[model samples]
Target: MKYVGRFAPSPSGPLHFGSLVAALGSYFQAKSQRGDWLVRMEDLDPPREMPGAAKLILETLEAYHLHWDGEVVYQSHRHELYQQQIEQWLSKQQAYYCQCTRKQIKAAGSYYQGQCRNKNLTADNCSIRIKIDAPVTEFVDLKQGKITLPSAIAAEDFIIKRRDGLFAYNLAVVIDDIEQGVTEVVRGADLIEPTGRQISLYQLLGAKPVQYLHLPLAVTENGAKLSKQNHAQGISLSDPIPTLICAMRFLGFVLPKQIETANIDEILAWGVKHWHLEQLPKATQITTLFSNRIS
Candidate 1:
């Protein structure tokens, strides 16, 4: 592996401070290792996407000097590929469809009891779920230490295709990462619970699993994370150098006072050369420093 990394963000809105932290952390780590850092636009769920958010995100990244190496991968364009993988899984009887409603799962209390496991049903109004194997319980994470999930959760049948005819995030991400040959994944810590499921998917697909790094969440003054739901403002693309410097500082980087006055390119050049992953906080949440100015 040549240290290929990707920052895949959902295009639900502009890149806010929280998302910026994620982007910068991943970007610096990749560049620090002298590796390729790529970007992928996760615009699979059309109903949840904003009209111009994708373009705005790219423009913002460009302003911040977080340039990507290859073409931006859009999940919407890969639906057919997901279908092909789903068909292969179905052929081996490794996957099945479930028509169970949310109301039913809520009553189970623990995990899906596989009510439709033996049911011979078409995937029309049903969601396709993967049959979880028990042994994929734990794996090494590049950031976090060894983790364990309940066997019920580890082996619980999870969805691959939604009843709404949309491909599930897990399946699509797995396919894209494998096909792209991504070697490392860095993202928010909230996604830790689903890592095992994704690892299982990689094994099922006979694809190598990428090293995982789940960073802490960026919380606000009120403790709620800065997100579209919380009305967090996007990072100002105007004069992004200061924003980039501030972000690097927030990630626990200690630059000479002179570099604080450095341009974005200079700051990033310093960043890529001195990036450290060991300094990242392992706590559940991180207090984000938001600013209105580049200085």
Candidate 2:
């Protein structure tokens, strides 16, 4: 199979420095191997999505010359496919409906106790969770190296569809990756916790396992990850070269000084030519005062 990689971003807000780092990391990783670099809009949660945010994200990518290979996929447009998978799992007894709420789970403990696994709950006012008979507690990350999750987290029956008639992140992502033939997932380290459960989903669905490369998260001075929720400033669109160079540096790329005067295409050519996975810092999170400027 050809090496296929993607940068799936949720349209909750405009692309920030952290988002650029992830996008550039995945883009270079794919381009370096002469692989297909695809982009997908993770706009599944409408309530949280910002108006015109998705369009702005694509524009930012274009401004930075990070073009994708195919049509941009929108998660909201794939409800039927997600529902079909949900029904298939339900019929096979691999998934079950649960009425457990956040408060209830918090009362139980950090991990869900599978209280509704045998409740025989109906679809009415219920969320869907998949059975975890075989847990994947460990996986080797391309950047972070060996990662091991607690058995409680790995063994818990995670949700596939929420009670609000929305498909869960784990479910939608795994299904989309499998359908798109994604060979690797390169993103921020904040998602490292969910890798094992996603692998478990792949096992349940019998899909080919995908490789993972988690880039070090760009965090604020206080150790908070730069995120839309935190109101992190969006990357510079008016003058993107400096910001683009900063993103490449975040990924551990050492560009020539002359490249600073080059255009986006030339900068990206240098990036793809010098991309190295081993150069990336192995830390999960890195604090940077350049969160706003990133230069």
Candidate 3:
């Protein structure tokens, strides 16, 4: 089967250095394998999304020479597709509506224990959750190797739709990957925990589960994951080569000393030619230099 990878970024903020690492890693991984690398804007959460962030991300990717294949997909426009599959699951009894609130679930247990499984509740004011009859306990990650989650944790029924009539990230992501025919998922290691849930969704939907490669996460000096919520400075496109080099080094790639002076196209061309998946460290989090730049 042809390899298809994607860089799906939420437009909650501009691409930070941490996100840039993910984008470049996914882009190079696809390009090196002669695979189709696509970009999808995960703009489902409108309240969290920033105006012009999507366009800025695309421009940033282009600036880094990480061009995507085909038209970029925006999740907001695909609500119908998510809703259709969600309805299908509901009709098949694969999913059910829940009236339980977040506080209620937290009080019950660390993970959801299917409180609404037998409720047969109406959809009004209720959230939709899938029944994880047989959860995926383990899966193989290309970089991280074998990953196992406890059955209890894995079997916890997860929400598919929020009470606010918005589609959940897990549901939307799985649906989009299936629809896009994503053969492989190459993203940050922060998402490792969600793989089992997503795999369960793939099985429930009868779609082939895509291969996963979770890259190491870029964290601050204090070990906090660099994220928009953390106020991570956006990647500096003004002088992208240094930033690109920093990402490559963070991924454990060894480049020539003088390569820092190379242009974007030259750097990316070299990156594609010498892409090495094994060079990526298996560690989940690595402190980044960006933390020092914080004023």
Candidate 4:
């Protein structure tokens, strides 16, 4: 089968170096394979989204010459699609309604310990959770190798639709990828922990989950991963090639120091020719030189 990969970015803030790595890595991996590479604007959570961040991200990727094959797919416009599948899950009882809040889950240590599993509650100002059973706990990642989830996370019921009446990332991503017919996922390793949950969701929904490749995360000096939460600086789109090349090098590309100085088109052409998905670091957390070194 032909490869179909995607670069999904949440527009909570401007694209930073860390997210750019995932974007470039996924884009190159797909383009290198002579497959369709798509960009998905993961703008589902409207509350935290920055007004211009989506446009900035597109501009940044365009400046880097990472052109996508089709029109960009925005999550907000696909609410009906999400809702259709969500309703299917709801009808089958594969999902259950939960009334647990943040404090309740945190009191049980962040992970949902399934307090409302037997409540059989109605869906009101209530979130929907998938009932995990006899989990297919272990899966093979192209980068991270065999990953096993803790029994707590593996068997624990997880949120699919939030109480606030919006879909959760796990549910939305699975639905979108399945509907988009994505074959492989190449993204940051920080999301590796959620793979098990995502995989479980797909199975319960009777869809084939894409092959996983979790790229290493970029962390800051304080040893925290780059994010708006960590205050990582936004990637300057004014001249994106060098920084993108450096990011590829950080991921262990052998494209040489010269590629780092090339024009955006030149760098992307070289990167597409030389990119290898296997060389990505397998660790869950990695300190990023680009995060700190970029002035």
Candidate 5:
């Protein structure tokens, strides 16, 4: 099968340094293997999404010369597809409806205890959750090796559709990957916890789950992950080459001295020619020094 990868970003904010690292890593990994790299906008959450953030993300990627394989996909336009899958799961008894609110779930404990598994609540005004009879407790990451989660976590009947009527991230991502024919998922390690749940969803749907390679997450000195919610500064397109070089180095790429001064295309070409996945940090998080860092 042809290798296919993607960089799916939420448009809640612009592309920050952390975002650039993921983009660069996934882009080079796919390009290095002579595969296709696609981009998808995870803009399903409108209340949190910035009005122009999607356009800005595309522009910034172009500025850094991280071009995608085809026209970018917007998740908002694919709601029908998600709804169809949800209905199929509901009819098949693989998913159930629950009226459990956030406060109720929190009152129980840190993780959901599947209180609604046998409730058989109607889906009219309730959330939809997959019935996890045999959860996926482990999966091997392409970079992180074998990863195992608590059996309780694996058995939790996680949400697939919210009470607010929006599709959950896990459900949307799995469907998108399957529909897009994604062969490999190369993103940050912060999302590693959800891999098992997604794998279970794939199995329930009778689709082959794609391979995973999670890159290290960039965090601040205070140990907070660099994110738009944390107000991490966005990437600067005004001086793209240096920022590109910084991301390349963050991924542990050893570049020729001449490549530092090269233009965007040249630097990217060098990256594809010499990219090494084994050199990536194995840890889940890597704190970036605030000073002398990519803007």
Candidate 6:
């Protein structure tokens, strides 16, 4: 099969330095391997989404010369596809309605204890969770080596749809990747925790599992991952070269000094030519003081 990779970002805010690292990392990985790289807008949560954020993200990618193949995909446009999978699992008894509240689960423990699995509950204001009979506790990451999840987390039943009538991240991501024929997932290490659950979802749905390569996360000196929630400053579009070079360096690329003066297309070409997964830092997070200068 041809190698296929994707960079799926939520429309919560503009692309920050951390987001640029992920985009550059994934884009180089795909381009280096002569693979098709796709962009996916994870806009399933309407309440949290910022207006015009998605358009800004695409413009940022273009500014950095990280062009994606084919048309961009928006998760909000595929509700019927998500609902069909939910109904199929519901009919097969592989998944059921969950009426448990956050407090109720917290009282139980850090991980859910399958409280609603046997409830035989209806869909009246209840989230839907899939049963995890055989958990996927570990998987080999292309860059991070072996990754193992706790038994509690691996065996726990996970939500596929929320009570507010929105599809859950795991459900939508797996389904979208499957539909898009994504051979591998190349993104930030912040999403590493959910890989096992996503793999389980692929298995449950009888789809081929995609390989994963989680790039190191860029965090502040205080150890907080640079994210939209933390209001990390967005990358500059007027002068994207500096931020783009910084992102490449963060991903362990050693660019020539002359590349600093190169244009966006030239820099990106150099990145693709020099892309090496083995050179990526194995650490999950890397604290950088340069993050403050991106803006």
Give the C-alpha lDDT of model 2: 0.91
* TM-score of decoy 4: 0.93
Look at candidate 5 and tell me the lDDT of residue 89: 84
Model 4 segments beyond 4 Å from truth? 108-110, 291-295
Q: Residues 155-260, candidate 3: write the lDDT tens digits.
A: 8888889999989989999989999989999999989888999999999878989999999999888899999898887887666877888898898888986666
lDDT of each structure?
0.84, 0.91, 0.88, 0.83, 0.89, 0.90
lDDT of 1 by residue, 220-262 (tens): 8778887866777888878776667667777778889888887
Candidate 3: where are CA atoms >4 Å away? 291-295
Which residue runs does candidate 5 get wrong by more than 4 Å? 290-295
lDDT of 4 by residue, 1-295 (tens): 8899999999888788888888888988898899999999999899989899899889878877888888899999999998887778778877788998999889889888878877889988899988888676789988777988777778878888899888889888988899888999999888877888999888877788899988888887678888866667888767666687678877778876677666778878887898786677656777766743323
How far is 102's C-alpha from truth in model 6 (Å)? Answer: 0.8
Per-prediction TM-score, please? 0.95, 0.97, 0.96, 0.93, 0.96, 0.97
After best superposition, candidate 4 residue 204: deviation in angstroms?
Answer: 1.4
Candidate 2 structure, TM-score to reference: 0.97
After superposing all C-alphas onto the true structure, candidate 1 shows an RMSD in angstroms of 1.9
Would you list the rank order by lDDT, best first? Answer: 2, 6, 5, 3, 1, 4
Candidate 1's displacement at residue 161, Å, is 0.4
Which candidate do you rate higher for lDDT, 2 or 5?
Answer: 2
* Candidate 1 structure lDDT: 0.84
